[model samples]
Structures are given as structure tokens and as C-alpha cells.
Target: MITYSTVKSTLIEKGTRILKVLQFGAKTADECAPFGDDSNPIANMTAIYAETSTVDEQVIIGYINTKQLAAPGEKRLYSLKNDKSISFYVWLRNNGILELGGDDHNLVRFEPLNQGIAAANGEINTELQKIQTAIIGLGGAYTAGHISTDIDAAKINEIKCL
Candidate 1:
């Protein structure tokens, strides 16, 4: 029989990682034609360009629970960030938290925080009663979003878990 305090401790112990974009959409060109092919008109078409970006890891904080689990209820809380704005939903499982929405019963009860804020107060108590069982750390993973390239304009300042 696991308790809320126990689950909360596990999530805090595991902590979270933030992903930052080191380089956004950098481009590079590759030459497909060989020296001998340079004289051919087709050689002009051999140049190809591709765009890519680099990312780094940072730290974030958040919370978790089993109110949304389908069977043996489980829950988790995570705080991670990337170069983009993201939205997260609860994931409940018999074992551990994982991608949002599967056999587990998803609760659309939670809402996003206001601008520049990562968490809000008093929201957990309202949903805590809905949980049924202790979550085992087997299949849990946080469901996150990539706010699109255009919106990822600045570096992440902070991530607070409540």
C-alpha cells in the first residue's frame, strides 16, 4: 500500500531534465557531384542544403499522481522545458507514468498555468481524491508539446514543480 507522500518523494528524487535549443535551424550544403562531373550541366543541381538544430539539457521541477489511471492507479509529476512552449497532461498507469492517453483513463481536469509561470497553487488537492491506487515506476513518460519553431524565441528561464 503506497501513500501520496511516497509517490511525491519518488517524483522529486527522479527530478526532471530541460532541453534547450543550442542552435535553431542551422543550414548546411552538400556537394553531390564529383570533379569529373563538374563540366556537366547536371553538376549544377548536385548541391543540396539541409537545416538542423542542436539542443542541450537543463533542469525542471513538477509533480505527479494516479487520479487518471485505469486500473491500479499511478501518477507522476515532471518539470522539463525546451526552446518552445509546451502543454502537459496527466498519465496514469498500473506501473509508471508514460505517454498521455492509452488504456488509462485520462482526466482532462487540469489546466495550463498563466504566462511565465510553471505551476499554480491549490490545484492538486481538488484532484487528489480521484486517484485509486499506487503507481509503480514501470511505464510512465511525460506527454509534452513543441510550441513550434516560430514561438521558441527565447531561452527557458525557469521551471517550477508544485
Candidate 2:
């Protein structure tokens, strides 16, 4: 009994807006450096890149951890965890990919080491059928008999009332 919207805009969620308001920080309680200190915030060379963020995620151009000398290349120096139980997104570690929020709480990033980029998004490609619907609305992919060179006398006549 689930209902879905047919409108193009409604089908697509406004991820960019969420990405804009999203705050990046360490998973630690203090929300600071890997060593649990608020002195150093920007440890990894992580930064936003390529148009601020993609429609699906926020594109950053820096490693997760490659700044701190303690645990070089250990993990993302900084990350956002849904400790507040916010059902917006989740932090993915083993895969180095944070995906849309779900019913799972395993790990969060609270270190400072490397340099990389992060792509944050909510429900990527949630509706695959939407693409097909768009294609159909556009008059389908192609047809052989109905479509022909306008230079053809019969084809031209078919298009006109003549």
C-alpha cells in the first residue's frame, strides 16, 4: 500500500540542501582532534571539491586520515556519526563510504591522520524506475518505421495533413 509520486521533482530528494547544512566533525564526544582535543580541527587535507557537492553526495578532495603522526592512515581523522539517533545518514568505515542513514550503529570516525575526500548522500538511486519513466515520457528510445529522413517525399507527406 505504499504510494509513490510520479512528479519528476518529488521523485528526487533534495540531497544537496541536506549536504549544505550537514556539519562535519569527529565522532568523539568533544568533536575535536584525533587525540580528543579541540585545538586542531582541520587535520586531514579533506576538503569539498567539484561544485561543492554532487546531487548524490558531498565531494571532498582529501583522505580521511593522513595528518596525525600517531596512527598514520588509520581512519578518517574526522567524521559525522548519528549518535543523536538522526535517521538521515550513517557512517561507513570498512568501505570508507558513508551511506544514507539506516537502522544500524556500528562505528564512527574519531581520528586525525590522512587526507582524502568524502561523498555524503541520502538514499542514492532510491528509485530506479524513475529513470525508465523519464525515458518513456520522452517518447521512448527509438523506432524504425515511424521515424525517417524528412527529405523522403512519403515521410514528409505523412507528417503533414497533405
| Residue 68 error, candidate 1, Å | 7.5
Best by TM-score: 2
* Candidate 1 residue-wise lDDT, 61-139, digit = tens: 1112212324546553232233212234445555654544343563221123232232222343323422312122344
| lDDT, candidates in the order shown | 0.28, 0.28
Summing lDDT over every window of 10 consecutive residues in candidate 2, give the lowest-scoring window: 112-121
Off by over 4 Å in 1: 1-69, 75-89, 101-162
TM-score per candidate: 0.13, 0.15
What TM-score quantifies how close candidate 1 is to the native fold? 0.13
lDDT of 2: 0.28
Worst 10 residues of 1 by lDDT: 1-10
